[model samples]
Target: MARIIGGLTTSHVPSIGKAIAQKEQESPYWKPFFDAFKPAHEWLAREKPDVAVVIYNDHGLNNFLDKMPTFAIGAAAEYHNADEGWGIPVLKPFRGHPKLSWHIIESLVADEFDITMCQEVLVDHAFTLPMALMYPGNIDWPVATVPVMLNSVQHPLPTARRCYKLGQAIGRAIDSFPEDIKVVLLGTGGLSHQLDGKRAGFINKPFDLWCMDKMRNDPEALARLSNHEIVEKAGSQGVELMTWIAMRAAMTGRVKELHATYHVPISNTGGAVMLFENNPQPHAIAAE
Candidate 1:
Protein backbone atom coordinates (compact mmCIF):
# COMPACT_ATOMS: atom_id res chain seq x y z
CA MET A 1 0.00 0.00 0.00
CA ALA A 2 1.09 3.58 -0.64
CA ARG A 3 1.33 6.12 2.14
CA ILE A 4 1.74 9.86 1.92
CA ILE A 5 5.29 10.36 3.18
CA GLY A 6 4.78 14.11 3.62
CA GLY A 7 3.98 17.47 1.99
CA LEU A 8 5.79 20.60 0.76
CA THR A 9 4.47 24.12 0.14
CA THR A 10 6.53 26.47 -2.04
CA SER A 11 5.99 29.59 -4.09
CA HIS A 12 6.21 29.18 -7.89
CA VAL A 13 7.44 32.65 -8.76
CA PRO A 14 9.83 32.29 -11.76
CA SER A 15 12.21 34.90 -10.40
CA ILE A 16 12.65 32.74 -7.29
CA GLY A 17 14.19 29.96 -9.38
CA LYS A 18 16.24 32.39 -11.48
CA ALA A 19 17.64 33.87 -8.29
CA ILE A 20 18.83 30.49 -7.03
CA ALA A 21 20.20 29.23 -10.35
CA GLN A 22 22.21 32.41 -10.98
CA LYS A 23 23.88 32.04 -7.54
CA GLU A 24 22.71 35.53 -6.63
CA GLN A 25 20.93 34.46 -3.44
CA GLU A 26 22.75 37.40 -1.86
CA SER A 27 19.94 39.71 -2.98
CA PRO A 28 18.41 41.03 0.23
CA TYR A 29 14.97 40.19 -1.10
CA TRP A 30 15.92 36.70 -2.35
CA LYS A 31 18.83 35.60 -0.13
CA PRO A 32 16.63 34.69 2.80
CA PHE A 33 14.63 32.39 0.50
CA PHE A 34 17.56 30.39 -0.93
CA ASP A 35 18.87 29.76 2.55
CA ALA A 36 15.47 28.46 3.64
CA PHE A 37 15.18 25.94 0.79
CA LYS A 38 18.40 24.13 1.77
CA PRO A 39 16.57 21.97 4.30
CA ALA A 40 13.88 20.96 1.80
CA HIS A 41 16.56 20.04 -0.71
CA GLU A 42 18.22 17.83 1.89
CA TRP A 43 14.96 16.27 3.13
CA LEU A 44 13.45 15.40 -0.27
CA ALA A 45 16.63 13.60 -1.32
CA ARG A 46 16.58 11.68 1.94
CA GLU A 47 12.98 10.56 1.41
CA LYS A 48 13.12 9.35 -2.16
CA PRO A 49 9.43 8.73 -2.59
CA ASP A 50 8.03 6.92 -5.60
CA VAL A 51 5.56 9.58 -6.75
CA ALA A 52 4.91 13.25 -6.09
CA VAL A 53 1.33 14.45 -6.53
CA VAL A 54 1.97 18.10 -7.44
CA ILE A 55 -0.93 20.52 -6.93
CA TYR A 56 -0.48 23.72 -8.96
CA ASN A 57 -2.53 26.23 -10.99
CA ASP A 58 -1.73 26.81 -14.63
CA HIS A 59 -1.19 30.38 -15.89
CA GLY A 60 -3.40 30.15 -18.98
CA LEU A 61 -1.07 27.57 -20.44
CA ASN A 62 -2.63 24.09 -20.59
CA ASN A 63 -6.14 25.06 -19.58
CA PHE A 64 -7.05 28.46 -20.97
CA LEU A 65 -10.12 30.68 -21.62
CA ASP A 66 -11.09 28.30 -24.38
CA LYS A 67 -12.01 25.79 -21.65
CA MET A 68 -10.84 25.33 -18.07
CA PRO A 69 -11.35 22.29 -15.94
CA THR A 70 -11.44 23.14 -12.25
CA PHE A 71 -9.13 20.14 -11.63
CA ALA A 72 -6.86 18.62 -14.28
CA ILE A 73 -4.36 15.76 -13.88
CA GLY A 74 -1.64 14.94 -16.37
CA ALA A 75 -2.29 11.38 -17.61
CA ALA A 76 -0.08 11.86 -20.63
CA ALA A 77 3.00 9.74 -21.20
CA GLU A 78 4.98 12.92 -21.81
CA TYR A 79 4.71 16.73 -21.38
CA HIS A 80 6.68 19.64 -22.86
CA ASN A 81 8.08 22.58 -20.94
CA ALA A 82 6.72 25.48 -22.96
CA ASP A 83 7.79 28.55 -21.02
CA GLU A 84 4.91 31.01 -20.95
CA GLY A 85 6.83 34.17 -20.01
CA TRP A 86 9.08 35.37 -17.14
CA GLY A 87 12.55 34.17 -18.23
CA ILE A 88 12.22 30.46 -19.13
CA PRO A 89 15.18 29.74 -21.37
CA VAL A 90 13.78 26.79 -23.29
CA LEU A 91 11.48 23.83 -22.95
CA LYS A 92 12.02 20.10 -23.22
CA PRO A 93 9.36 17.44 -23.42
CA PHE A 94 8.63 16.04 -19.92
CA ARG A 95 8.06 12.34 -19.84
CA GLY A 96 5.08 11.07 -17.88
CA HIS A 97 4.12 7.88 -16.04
CA PRO A 98 0.93 6.88 -17.84
CA LYS A 99 0.49 3.70 -15.81
CA LEU A 100 0.44 5.54 -12.51
CA SER A 101 -1.19 8.68 -13.95
CA TRP A 102 -4.10 6.76 -15.42
CA HIS A 103 -4.41 4.67 -12.30
CA ILE A 104 -4.78 7.78 -10.12
CA ILE A 105 -7.17 9.47 -12.56
CA GLU A 106 -9.41 6.45 -12.68
CA SER A 107 -9.34 6.19 -8.93
CA LEU A 108 -10.19 9.90 -8.54
CA VAL A 109 -13.06 9.60 -11.00
CA ALA A 110 -14.35 6.58 -9.13
CA ASP A 111 -13.95 8.53 -5.92
CA GLU A 112 -16.04 11.29 -7.59
CA PHE A 113 -13.35 13.96 -7.57
CA ASP A 114 -14.26 14.92 -11.19
CA ILE A 115 -10.85 15.72 -12.63
CA THR A 116 -9.70 16.53 -16.17
CA MET A 117 -7.11 13.98 -17.29
CA CYS A 118 -4.66 15.03 -20.01
CA GLN A 119 -3.11 12.56 -22.45
CA GLU A 120 -0.69 15.13 -23.87
CA VAL A 121 -0.39 18.36 -21.89
CA LEU A 122 2.15 21.16 -22.16
CA VAL A 123 3.22 22.59 -18.75
CA ASP A 124 4.50 26.10 -18.19
CA HIS A 125 6.14 27.69 -15.13
CA ALA A 126 3.43 26.38 -12.85
CA PHE A 127 5.06 22.95 -13.10
CA THR A 128 8.58 23.92 -14.14
CA LEU A 129 9.08 26.71 -11.60
CA PRO A 130 8.93 24.19 -8.74
CA MET A 131 11.53 22.13 -10.55
CA ALA A 132 13.86 25.12 -10.77
CA LEU A 133 13.09 26.66 -7.38
CA MET A 134 12.81 23.83 -4.85
CA TYR A 135 14.35 20.81 -6.59
CA PRO A 136 16.74 22.90 -8.74
CA GLY A 137 18.40 21.44 -11.87
CA ASN A 138 21.32 20.18 -9.79
CA ILE A 139 19.21 17.59 -7.97
CA ASP A 140 17.85 14.52 -9.68
CA TRP A 141 14.02 14.33 -9.50
CA PRO A 142 13.61 10.57 -9.74
CA VAL A 143 10.01 10.27 -8.58
CA ALA A 144 7.08 10.24 -10.96
CA THR A 145 4.86 13.37 -10.65
CA VAL A 146 1.18 13.99 -11.22
CA PRO A 147 0.28 17.61 -12.01
CA VAL A 148 -3.06 18.75 -10.52
CA MET A 149 -4.23 22.08 -11.96
CA LEU A 150 -6.62 24.53 -10.34
CA ASN A 151 -8.21 27.52 -12.12
CA SER A 152 -6.82 30.47 -10.17
CA VAL A 153 -5.65 32.84 -12.92
CA GLN A 154 -9.20 33.07 -14.22
CA HIS A 155 -12.55 33.52 -12.57
CA PRO A 156 -15.11 30.74 -11.85
CA LEU A 157 -12.62 28.67 -9.89
CA PRO A 158 -13.54 25.90 -7.47
CA THR A 159 -14.57 26.90 -3.97
CA ALA A 160 -12.19 26.34 -1.05
CA ARG A 161 -14.26 23.53 0.42
CA ARG A 162 -14.50 21.84 -2.96
CA CYS A 163 -10.72 21.89 -3.42
CA TYR A 164 -10.30 20.50 0.08
CA LYS A 165 -12.60 17.60 -0.68
CA LEU A 166 -10.60 16.85 -3.83
CA GLY A 167 -7.46 16.64 -1.76
CA GLN A 168 -9.09 14.11 0.51
CA ALA A 169 -10.02 12.08 -2.53
CA ILE A 170 -6.38 12.15 -3.69
CA GLY A 171 -5.25 10.79 -0.35
CA ARG A 172 -7.74 7.97 -0.54
CA ALA A 173 -6.69 7.14 -4.09
CA ILE A 174 -3.01 7.03 -3.18
CA ASP A 175 -3.67 4.79 -0.22
CA SER A 176 -5.60 2.45 -2.48
CA PHE A 177 -2.66 1.81 -4.77
CA PRO A 178 -1.90 -1.92 -4.53
CA GLU A 179 1.86 -1.77 -4.62
CA ASP A 180 4.02 -0.32 -1.86
CA ILE A 181 4.89 3.27 -2.66
CA LYS A 182 5.52 6.52 -0.86
CA VAL A 183 3.66 9.59 -2.13
CA VAL A 184 4.45 13.27 -1.70
CA LEU A 185 1.37 15.49 -1.96
CA LEU A 186 2.52 19.02 -2.78
CA GLY A 187 0.24 22.09 -2.79
CA THR A 188 2.10 24.99 -4.43
CA GLY A 189 0.88 28.61 -4.42
CA GLY A 190 0.34 31.68 -2.36
CA LEU A 191 1.63 33.29 0.83
CA SER A 192 -0.51 36.41 0.61
CA HIS A 193 0.48 38.43 -2.43
CA GLN A 194 -1.11 39.82 -5.60
CA LEU A 195 0.33 40.21 -9.10
CA ASP A 196 -2.07 42.41 -10.99
CA GLY A 197 -4.64 45.23 -10.95
CA LYS A 198 -4.66 48.45 -8.88
CA ARG A 199 -3.96 46.52 -5.65
CA ALA A 200 -0.82 44.81 -6.87
CA GLY A 201 2.45 44.37 -4.90
CA PHE A 202 0.83 43.26 -1.69
CA ILE A 203 2.71 41.22 0.98
CA ASN A 204 0.96 40.04 4.13
CA LYS A 205 3.55 38.08 6.14
CA PRO A 206 1.42 38.15 9.26
CA PHE A 207 -1.48 36.61 7.39
CA ASP A 208 0.88 34.18 5.64
CA LEU A 209 2.19 32.76 8.92
CA TRP A 210 -1.32 32.77 10.36
CA CYS A 211 -2.53 30.69 7.44
CA MET A 212 0.37 28.24 7.87
CA ASP A 213 -0.29 27.87 11.59
CA LYS A 214 -3.99 27.37 10.97
CA MET A 215 -3.19 24.90 8.23
CA ARG A 216 -1.01 22.82 10.53
CA ASN A 217 -2.94 23.25 13.76
CA ASP A 218 -6.56 24.11 12.98
CA PRO A 219 -7.38 23.23 9.39
CA GLU A 220 -11.16 23.32 9.71
CA ALA A 221 -11.14 27.04 10.35
CA LEU A 222 -8.60 27.57 7.60
CA ALA A 223 -10.67 25.51 5.18
CA ARG A 224 -13.72 27.53 6.08
CA LEU A 225 -11.92 30.79 5.35
CA SER A 226 -13.79 32.37 2.42
CA ASN A 227 -12.25 32.90 -0.99
CA HIS A 228 -13.03 36.58 -0.71
CA GLU A 229 -11.29 36.63 2.67
CA ILE A 230 -8.24 34.97 1.15
CA VAL A 231 -8.22 37.51 -1.66
CA GLU A 232 -8.78 40.45 0.67
CA LYS A 233 -6.06 39.40 3.12
CA ALA A 234 -3.79 37.31 0.87
CA GLY A 235 -4.20 39.49 -2.22
CA SER A 236 -6.39 39.00 -5.30
CA GLN A 237 -4.21 36.29 -6.84
CA GLY A 238 -3.65 34.81 -3.41
CA VAL A 239 -7.05 33.17 -3.76
CA GLU A 240 -4.96 30.31 -5.11
CA LEU A 241 -4.18 29.36 -1.53
CA MET A 242 -7.46 27.48 -1.69
CA THR A 243 -5.47 24.64 -3.20
CA TRP A 244 -3.22 24.55 -0.17
CA ILE A 245 -6.25 23.91 1.98
CA ALA A 246 -6.95 20.83 -0.09
CA MET A 247 -3.46 19.50 0.43
CA ARG A 248 -3.71 20.11 4.15
CA ALA A 249 -7.09 18.42 4.32
CA ALA A 250 -5.73 15.34 2.58
CA MET A 251 -2.85 15.01 4.99
CA THR A 252 -5.09 15.71 7.96
CA GLY A 253 -3.04 15.19 11.16
CA ARG A 254 -0.27 13.15 9.52
CA VAL A 255 2.25 15.95 9.26
CA LYS A 256 5.60 17.00 10.76
CA GLU A 257 7.52 20.17 10.07
CA LEU A 258 10.87 19.76 8.30
CA HIS A 259 11.51 23.35 7.25
CA ALA A 260 9.70 26.69 6.88
CA THR A 261 10.64 30.01 5.20
CA TYR A 262 8.79 33.06 3.80
CA HIS A 263 10.01 36.11 1.89
CA VAL A 264 8.73 39.00 -0.25
CA PRO A 265 11.13 40.70 -2.61
CA ILE A 266 9.49 42.41 -5.60
CA SER A 267 6.19 44.19 -5.36
CA ASN A 268 2.80 42.58 -5.92
CA THR A 269 3.59 39.23 -4.14
CA GLY A 270 5.35 37.27 -1.43
CA GLY A 271 7.01 33.82 -1.81
CA ALA A 272 7.25 31.13 0.81
CA VAL A 273 8.22 27.44 1.13
CA MET A 274 7.46 25.05 3.99
CA LEU A 275 8.32 21.33 4.03
CA PHE A 276 6.94 18.52 6.21
CA GLU A 277 7.43 14.83 6.81
CA ASN A 278 4.04 13.10 6.54
CA ASN A 279 5.48 10.14 8.41
CA PRO A 280 8.46 9.60 10.66
CA GLN A 281 10.58 8.03 7.95
CA PRO A 282 10.56 7.41 4.17
CA HIS A 283 12.91 5.60 1.77
CA ALA A 284 15.84 7.29 0.09
CA ILE A 285 14.85 5.41 -3.07
CA ALA A 286 11.41 4.56 -4.51
CA ALA A 287 10.32 2.33 -7.39
CA GLU A 288 7.50 3.99 -9.25
Candidate 2:
Protein backbone atom coordinates (compact mmCIF):
# COMPACT_ATOMS: atom_id res chain seq x y z
CA MET A 1 0.00 0.00 0.00
CA ALA A 2 1.03 3.59 -0.58
CA ARG A 3 2.39 5.02 2.68
CA ILE A 4 2.86 8.55 3.99
CA ILE A 5 6.42 8.70 5.21
CA GLY A 6 6.47 12.29 6.45
CA GLY A 7 5.33 15.91 6.14
CA LEU A 8 6.94 19.37 5.95
CA THR A 9 5.96 23.00 6.62
CA THR A 10 7.66 26.13 5.34
CA SER A 11 7.15 29.82 4.74
CA HIS A 12 6.80 30.53 1.01
CA VAL A 13 8.03 34.10 0.82
CA PRO A 14 8.88 35.21 -2.72
CA SER A 15 12.12 36.84 -1.60
CA ILE A 16 13.43 33.40 -0.60
CA GLY A 17 13.13 32.42 -4.25
CA LYS A 18 15.09 35.51 -5.26
CA ALA A 19 17.80 34.64 -2.75
CA ILE A 20 18.13 31.12 -4.18
CA ALA A 21 18.11 32.28 -7.81
CA GLN A 22 20.84 34.82 -7.05
CA LYS A 23 23.01 32.00 -5.62
CA GLU A 24 23.42 33.98 -2.43
CA GLN A 25 22.57 31.14 -0.09
CA GLU A 26 26.02 31.18 1.47
CA SER A 27 26.00 34.95 1.97
CA PRO A 28 25.18 36.47 5.38
CA TYR A 29 21.75 37.73 4.34
CA TRP A 30 20.51 34.41 2.95
CA LYS A 31 22.67 31.93 4.85
CA PRO A 32 20.26 31.30 7.71
CA PHE A 33 17.35 30.56 5.38
CA PHE A 34 19.23 28.24 3.06
CA ASP A 35 21.26 26.58 5.79
CA ALA A 36 18.06 25.69 7.60
CA PHE A 37 16.88 23.44 4.79
CA LYS A 38 20.22 21.63 4.42
CA PRO A 39 19.16 18.88 6.80
CA ALA A 40 15.78 18.52 5.10
CA HIS A 41 17.34 18.30 1.64
CA GLU A 42 19.76 15.66 2.87
CA TRP A 43 16.93 13.74 4.49
CA LEU A 44 14.85 13.90 1.31
CA ALA A 45 17.82 12.67 -0.65
CA ARG A 46 17.87 9.58 1.55
CA GLU A 47 14.10 8.98 1.98
CA LYS A 48 13.42 9.45 -1.73
CA PRO A 49 9.65 9.42 -1.75
CA ASP A 50 7.90 8.54 -5.02
CA VAL A 51 5.49 11.51 -4.84
CA ALA A 52 5.00 14.82 -3.08
CA VAL A 53 1.51 16.11 -2.29
CA VAL A 54 2.18 19.82 -1.96
CA ILE A 55 -0.48 22.00 -0.32
CA TYR A 56 -0.02 25.65 -1.22
CA ASN A 57 -1.97 28.78 -2.14
CA ASP A 58 -1.76 30.66 -5.44
CA HIS A 59 -0.79 34.32 -5.55
CA GLY A 60 -2.67 35.84 -8.52
CA LEU A 61 -0.74 33.68 -11.01
CA ASN A 62 -2.80 30.91 -12.60
CA ASN A 63 -5.52 31.52 -10.04
CA PHE A 64 -6.87 35.02 -10.42
CA LEU A 65 -9.82 36.38 -8.45
CA ASP A 66 -12.30 35.60 -11.21
CA LYS A 67 -12.58 31.80 -10.99
CA MET A 68 -10.81 30.54 -7.89
CA PRO A 69 -11.60 27.18 -6.45
CA THR A 70 -11.40 26.81 -2.67
CA PHE A 71 -9.39 23.63 -3.27
CA ALA A 72 -7.85 22.44 -6.54
CA ILE A 73 -5.82 19.35 -7.47
CA GLY A 74 -3.54 19.13 -10.51
CA ALA A 75 -3.95 15.94 -12.53
CA ALA A 76 -1.79 17.09 -15.41
CA ALA A 77 1.04 14.95 -16.73
CA GLU A 78 3.38 17.89 -16.17
CA TYR A 79 3.21 21.42 -14.74
CA HIS A 80 4.90 24.54 -16.09
CA ASN A 81 6.77 27.01 -13.93
CA ALA A 82 4.99 30.06 -15.31
CA ASP A 83 6.28 33.57 -14.86
CA GLU A 84 4.09 35.25 -12.22
CA GLY A 85 4.21 38.60 -14.15
CA TRP A 86 7.34 39.99 -12.42
CA GLY A 87 9.87 37.98 -14.45
CA ILE A 88 11.14 35.56 -11.84
CA PRO A 89 13.32 33.02 -13.67
CA VAL A 90 11.15 29.97 -14.33
CA LEU A 91 12.29 26.48 -13.48
CA LYS A 92 11.99 23.35 -15.58
CA PRO A 93 8.60 21.69 -15.98
CA PHE A 94 7.68 19.63 -12.91
CA ARG A 95 6.62 16.09 -13.66
CA GLY A 96 3.19 15.15 -12.25
CA HIS A 97 1.67 11.84 -11.12
CA PRO A 98 -1.66 11.94 -12.96
CA LYS A 99 -2.92 8.57 -11.81
CA LEU A 100 -2.36 9.35 -8.13
CA SER A 101 -3.83 12.81 -8.59
CA TRP A 102 -6.97 11.35 -10.13
CA HIS A 103 -7.24 8.79 -7.37
CA ILE A 104 -7.06 11.57 -4.76
CA ILE A 105 -9.65 13.59 -6.65
CA GLU A 106 -12.06 10.67 -6.77
CA SER A 107 -11.50 9.87 -3.11
CA LEU A 108 -12.05 13.48 -2.03
CA VAL A 109 -15.20 13.77 -4.15
CA ALA A 110 -16.60 10.55 -2.74
CA ASP A 111 -15.93 11.89 0.74
CA GLU A 112 -17.92 15.06 -0.08
CA PHE A 113 -15.01 17.44 -0.43
CA ASP A 114 -15.54 19.49 -3.61
CA ILE A 115 -12.26 20.00 -5.46
CA THR A 116 -11.39 21.62 -8.77
CA MET A 117 -9.59 19.22 -11.11
CA CYS A 118 -6.87 20.91 -13.21
CA GLN A 119 -5.46 19.01 -16.17
CA GLU A 120 -3.21 22.01 -16.88
CA VAL A 121 -2.02 24.69 -14.47
CA LEU A 122 0.72 27.25 -14.08
CA VAL A 123 2.37 27.06 -10.68
CA ASP A 124 3.41 30.36 -9.12
CA HIS A 125 6.07 31.27 -6.54
CA ALA A 126 3.99 29.83 -3.73
CA PHE A 127 4.70 26.36 -5.08
CA THR A 128 8.12 26.88 -6.66
CA LEU A 129 9.84 28.74 -3.84
CA PRO A 130 9.31 25.84 -1.47
CA MET A 131 10.54 23.47 -4.15
CA ALA A 132 13.73 25.49 -4.53
CA LEU A 133 14.31 25.34 -0.78
CA MET A 134 13.63 21.63 -0.50
CA TYR A 135 15.75 20.62 -3.47
CA PRO A 136 18.40 23.29 -4.02
CA GLY A 137 21.04 22.77 -6.72
CA ASN A 138 18.96 20.21 -8.57
CA ILE A 139 18.39 20.38 -12.33
CA ASP A 140 15.21 18.34 -12.03
CA TRP A 141 13.18 17.31 -8.97
CA PRO A 142 13.66 13.68 -8.03
CA VAL A 143 10.03 12.71 -7.46
CA ALA A 144 6.76 13.30 -9.33
CA THR A 145 4.37 15.72 -7.60
CA VAL A 146 0.67 16.24 -7.02
CA PRO A 147 -0.23 19.87 -6.43
CA VAL A 148 -2.97 20.43 -3.87
CA MET A 149 -3.77 24.14 -4.19
CA LEU A 150 -5.66 25.69 -1.30
CA ASN A 151 -7.32 29.15 -1.38
CA SER A 152 -5.42 31.58 0.84
CA VAL A 153 -5.65 34.59 -1.47
CA GLN A 154 -9.44 34.81 -1.56
CA HIS A 155 -11.90 35.45 1.23
CA PRO A 156 -14.31 32.74 2.40
CA LEU A 157 -11.28 30.50 2.34
CA PRO A 158 -11.61 27.04 3.78
CA THR A 159 -11.45 27.17 7.58
CA ALA A 160 -8.68 25.55 9.63
CA ARG A 161 -11.09 22.84 10.78
CA ARG A 162 -12.12 21.99 7.25
CA CYS A 163 -8.53 21.87 6.05
CA TYR A 164 -7.66 19.43 8.82
CA LYS A 165 -10.59 17.19 7.99
CA LEU A 166 -9.72 17.30 4.30
CA GLY A 167 -6.23 16.15 5.23
CA GLN A 168 -7.64 13.22 7.16
CA ALA A 169 -9.58 12.22 4.04
CA ILE A 170 -6.44 12.47 1.95
CA GLY A 171 -4.52 10.24 4.37
CA ARG A 172 -7.22 7.62 4.04
CA ALA A 173 -7.06 7.87 0.26
CA ILE A 174 -3.32 7.37 0.21
CA ASP A 175 -3.58 4.32 2.45
CA SER A 176 -6.20 2.78 0.16
CA PHE A 177 -4.11 3.09 -2.99
CA PRO A 178 -2.62 -0.27 -4.00
CA GLU A 179 0.69 1.00 -5.35
CA ASP A 180 3.73 0.51 -3.16
CA ILE A 181 4.56 4.16 -3.14
CA LYS A 182 6.10 6.43 -0.53
CA VAL A 183 4.49 9.88 -0.22
CA VAL A 184 5.46 13.18 1.36
CA LEU A 185 2.99 15.90 2.35
CA LEU A 186 4.18 19.47 2.27
CA GLY A 187 2.36 22.44 3.84
CA THR A 188 3.92 25.55 2.37
CA GLY A 189 3.53 29.18 3.48
CA GLY A 190 3.57 31.39 6.52
CA LEU A 191 4.93 31.93 10.01
CA SER A 192 3.38 35.42 10.32
CA HIS A 193 3.97 38.49 8.15
CA GLN A 194 1.71 40.85 6.24
CA LEU A 195 2.45 42.18 2.73
CA ASP A 196 -0.26 44.78 2.12
CA GLY A 197 -1.90 47.91 3.46
CA LYS A 198 -0.32 49.97 6.28
CA ARG A 199 0.61 46.75 8.04
CA ALA A 200 2.83 45.55 5.24
CA GLY A 201 6.02 44.87 7.17
CA PHE A 202 4.48 43.16 10.19
CA ILE A 203 6.18 40.10 11.71
CA ASN A 204 5.03 38.37 14.89
CA LYS A 205 7.79 36.09 16.12
CA PRO A 206 6.26 35.08 19.44
CA PHE A 207 2.96 34.13 17.88
CA ASP A 208 4.67 32.28 15.06
CA LEU A 209 6.82 30.26 17.44
CA TRP A 210 3.87 29.53 19.68
CA CYS A 211 1.85 28.21 16.76
CA MET A 212 4.78 26.11 15.57
CA ASP A 213 5.27 24.59 19.02
CA LYS A 214 1.57 23.86 19.29
CA MET A 215 1.56 22.21 15.91
CA ARG A 216 4.52 20.08 16.87
CA ASN A 217 3.22 18.99 20.24
CA ASP A 218 -0.57 18.99 20.07
CA PRO A 219 -1.91 19.42 16.56
CA GLU A 220 -5.36 18.41 17.74
CA ALA A 221 -5.57 21.68 19.64
CA LEU A 222 -4.20 23.45 16.59
CA ALA A 223 -7.07 21.99 14.56
CA ARG A 224 -9.59 23.54 16.96
CA LEU A 225 -8.16 26.98 16.14
CA SER A 226 -10.37 29.03 13.85
CA ASN A 227 -9.18 31.10 10.90
CA HIS A 228 -10.36 34.33 12.50
CA GLU A 229 -8.31 33.55 15.59
CA ILE A 230 -5.24 32.69 13.53
CA VAL A 231 -5.49 35.89 11.51
CA GLU A 232 -6.02 37.95 14.61
CA LYS A 233 -3.05 36.44 16.42
CA ALA A 234 -0.56 35.72 13.62
CA GLY A 235 -1.38 38.63 11.25
CA SER A 236 -3.44 38.42 8.07
CA GLN A 237 -0.90 36.54 5.95
CA GLY A 238 -0.51 33.96 8.71
CA VAL A 239 -3.75 32.48 7.42
CA GLU A 240 -1.53 30.51 5.10
CA LEU A 241 -0.70 28.27 8.05
CA MET A 242 -3.92 26.43 7.24
CA THR A 243 -1.85 24.40 4.84
CA TRP A 244 0.45 23.42 7.69
CA ILE A 245 -2.46 22.22 9.77
CA ALA A 246 -3.76 20.05 6.95
CA MET A 247 -0.36 18.52 6.34
CA ARG A 248 -0.02 17.61 10.01
CA ALA A 249 -3.55 16.28 10.29
CA ALA A 250 -3.02 14.01 7.29
CA MET A 251 -0.66 11.74 9.15
CA THR A 252 -1.60 9.19 11.79
CA GLY A 253 -0.26 9.18 15.41
CA ARG A 254 2.04 11.73 16.95
CA VAL A 255 4.64 13.35 14.66
CA LYS A 256 8.28 13.59 15.52
CA GLU A 257 9.66 17.00 14.53
CA LEU A 258 13.00 16.26 12.98
CA HIS A 259 14.30 19.73 12.18
CA ALA A 260 13.15 23.36 12.23
CA THR A 261 14.43 26.78 11.04
CA TYR A 262 13.04 30.23 11.68
CA HIS A 263 14.29 33.69 10.75
CA VAL A 264 12.87 37.18 10.83
CA PRO A 265 12.45 39.91 8.19
CA ILE A 266 12.59 37.90 4.98
CA SER A 267 11.08 40.56 2.75
CA ASN A 268 8.35 41.47 5.20
CA THR A 269 7.72 37.86 6.13
CA GLY A 270 8.61 35.59 9.03
CA GLY A 271 10.44 32.72 7.36
CA ALA A 272 10.34 29.22 8.86
CA VAL A 273 10.75 25.56 7.91
CA MET A 274 9.96 22.32 9.77
CA LEU A 275 10.26 18.62 8.91
CA PHE A 276 8.20 15.89 10.60
CA GLU A 277 7.98 12.10 10.55
CA ASN A 278 4.83 10.30 11.68
CA ASN A 279 4.91 7.68 14.44
CA PRO A 280 3.95 4.19 13.40
CA GLN A 281 1.52 3.78 16.28
CA PRO A 282 -1.58 5.97 16.60
CA HIS A 283 -2.15 8.22 19.60
CA ALA A 284 -4.84 7.19 22.05
CA ILE A 285 -6.02 10.73 22.81
CA ALA A 286 -9.06 12.13 21.02
CA ALA A 287 -8.61 14.73 18.28
CA GLU A 288 -10.35 17.69 19.84
Query: In lDDT terms, how accurate is model 1?
Result: 0.75
Q: For candidate 1, write residues 170-217 as lDDT tens digits.
A: 877776677788887778878787878888788888998898787767
TM-score of 1: 0.90
Name the lDDT value of residue 11 in candidate 1: 74
Write candidate 2's Cα lDDT for 46-118 as tens digits. 8999999999988888888889899999999999888777767887889999999999999999999999999
Best by TM-score: 2
TM-score of each: 0.90, 0.95
Please give the lDDT score at residue 169 for candidate 1.
80
Looking at candidate 1, what is the lDDT of residue 231?
A: 86
Q: What RMSD does each model have against the real structure?
A: 3.7, 3.1
Which window of ten consecutive residues has the lowest lDDT sum in model 1?
Answer: 279-288
